[model samples]
Target: MKQSLTRRAMLGALGTAVAATAGCQSPGTGSDSGSDTGEQPESADAVAQSDSVYTNVYQEVADAVVSIRVYAEDSRGGQGSGFLIDDEHIVTNEHVVAGGDEYYVRFADTGWRTASVVGADVYSDLAVLRIGATPDVTPLSFVETEPTVGTEVVAIGNPFGLSGSVSAGIVSGVDRTLQSANNFSIADAVQTDAPVNPGNSGGPLVTLEGDVVGVINSGGGDNVAFAISAPLTQRVVPSLIQTGDYDHPYMGVGLRSVSPRVAEANNLDPGSGVYITRVVSDGPAAGVLQGSDGETTISGTAIPTGGDVVRQMDDTPTPTRQALGSFLALETSPGETVDVLVERDGAQETVELTLGTRPEP
Candidate 1:
């Protein structure tokens, strides 16, 4: 089962979150990057500004931004936020309502209404909700472009129980991988500094123009915060809302970036590709592929290893394991077979390995 995010843990595949309903400060104060107390630069000219970017953004998105409340057994319910993608559908992190509990949605003006999960994908950390009643709500349009570095964005949610709180910041980085509470890596994420907190999970990370670009997920380490990208969400959202799983190719070898020392000891080019750090015993790569074995020393550094150095995935060259993982997701499927090129013993060879099911972790 997915652990609740409130417990400072999460279930595998972006499981549930426990939102806060009370005990929070004004939005920007909780996170240092979002300093609410700072005075705004005011212009003396009459009627400073109107019809600006963020104008009506909150009002437009508020009807769509819902307060999510979930109830589990043992009287341990959780809280989080979600946004409506359509009048009837909503998007949120899978962790917002994991464990198949009863869920409800509360609007800015309305009371709680029942909600049901349409579909959820753990690999992508996305879920869709069907609002029970046909309440009038405005859905935020999604931004088309992937957010660029230094792009201004806003974070909106009920942080630590304060509803209707919003903060602003810029895109810090992209394609970041963070370790989830369950010790699994949430890959290809968007990093921001917009003050995401416990209650902010599953809320919208919108543009200055009010278009949603990502879903706020987590924060830590000085001013670091992160979200799952909207483009990724767009690619996987439909399938997740319709099916509980997102299908992708499964390569059975554990891999890592080939370090300089290991590559030299193995008589291979380190920067040229990723190294298959481990192969599951009797797994797909065991009989068809060759890899490192026994102890080797280079530059007086000893390394115990076994597995092949991957030079390419199909037609694309992969220089790191993370790149290989992203590549695999793009061009493979479960139960498919593909040619893998590997370098072993100062020679390059190719072998076809049938993909296998990703074992439960």
Candidate 2:
């Protein structure tokens, strides 16, 4: 039997490319407009002033961003960029160093150092490296809060292995669910259009003030780019640094968003919750959440009904599979009881299951 690669694994290795050359809005996405010719100010200083917003941000951040060149069994090797998080650690996308036997770090001054993967988390597409502590190398500050839509952002990375490359744009969206190289859907990713491309994965997405808001993860389609949020990094990096992995609570089940047709067939309102699709055998959820079996027709379509619809988790409403996964990650450990509200038999009931820890990739 051939083993199938998970979306998370693929994304961890390549950062999920936008699926098509076409488009997908991903819920809250919208188009942005530029200033019209008439709205443009005549004074050069005015234009300079707006442009200056990103000047210091990039200068201060570029020093922290370093080129990562990974040498694998495959000939030419691969290249990406990462930023210094501290004297001893460098952060980059897991894909950058994937399948590598050796790693190299290069600085803007043409300085180079040998490096190794301290740890990496494929599910989050984050990896860290250990290099000898160097002086005068400043780490970029992380954003304390979520970046808002329209906030000016900048991307500094090694696009196509070209170091010190910089591009600018605004926060295009927030909280998007996208597949990681590891086949797991990374919840709440920050999307930007800072001209990110291959080799940009693992770079820092900085705000106008130079604070790191997100880590570059993937790019494609309509010039879109995605990054894992800083908060998610805050949760995963320490563990990766210490153990090379982070424990994620698991209640083994496959799920999908509840569509209007699914809602109507189940006699529930559409746009309300996520529908459970399958339960992994012997998993934590198997004994806690009951599965229903039937054949039902919705809008002249026949669909199998086996799994339950999840409405909430721990009193927190989970409207989609992404929301459920996000909530699960927020919890601390395995054996911890979390309340899950499910829809069944024309009613809602809460089931408490002690989540189990999934093995790290």
Candidate 3:
């Protein structure tokens, strides 16, 4: 399991480290000890070495990160962060530009420039912005490989209107599911301990090598924050740019992960797969997939029974709701036909279903 630090504890530890470091230096040993000059007490070399990796990443990527200010039709406005993905385009969260009549972005090297929403996808919480011209900075690229747990990462964004802010921590979890609008969940998310707050959304969560691994999504102020994974972003952003929207494959069915009680009620292996609670009438899985036909009580808890327990989709094991959502989001398209393997009546069977485009939220 990953370790966590409360805000008070983290600050306390920082204070202790500072105090211990100060105590380590001899009182009259440094060259500027007796001087009245207000320069830094430590040599430039020492300061550079202390935070070389973070410093280098910040210098390399900060120029391309932008602060976004959004103005709504009714004089309401908010701010968030984003980063350039190309010479003329920027990537941000869909929620950031929602209900905005005007969008403006400011780069570290340039003044605020007018921008337009080229596309936005609420399902994935990703949006693309087009600017007439951008500062002479290289666009950030997503990491080619998935970052493993404990990989060092940084969140670069404007938090609470503070521009050019950077926070550092390790990737604490992967393949996480985050709640989104429309009662849906954003799947395959990356969780980090990097301190992100309001206004950090839409910014790049990059690795030490300056490659973006995720897009900063939300933070709970409890040493926990989440980002849309780079793999999902890569899938959604291109379609948004090309067509002004992205179509998500939809399965119109309510699902629940198989828990101990649910497993017992449904006669399933404990904690094995996802259960289909209700399949929408006339929906993609209406005729092909089976939903729960009865309910039972286990330990005074009502559990849906007689439902299809989905074990796999397209040969990919969907052991949880997160795995199922990720498979639909990343591996299939709106019109693709996928093989769904489910255990029904204590027997396993495979069924093919053509996916459908998700309805507007």
Candidate 2 structure quality by residue, lDDT tens digits, 116-190: 898887878889999875548677779989999988688888888777777778899987887864456787789
Tens-place lDDT per residue, model 1, 104-134, is 9887778888999887766667788997665
Candidates in descending TM-score order: 3, 2, 1
Clashing pairs in 3: none
Candidate 1, residue 296: the lDDT equals 79
What's the TM for model 2? Answer: 0.83
Q: lDDT values of the candidates?
A: 0.69, 0.75, 0.85
Model 1: residues with Cα > 4 Å off, grouped in runs: 1-56, 180-184, 270-272, 282-284, 297-302, 336-339
How do all models score by TM-score? 0.77, 0.83, 0.88
Candidate 1 positional error at 126, Å: 2.2
Q: On a 0 to 100 scale, what is the lDDT of residue 247 in model 2?
A: 78
lDDT tens digits by residue: candidate 3, 136-199: 8899999999899998888898888888777888899999998877788888999999888899
Candidate 3 residue 80 C-alpha distance from true site, Å: 0.1
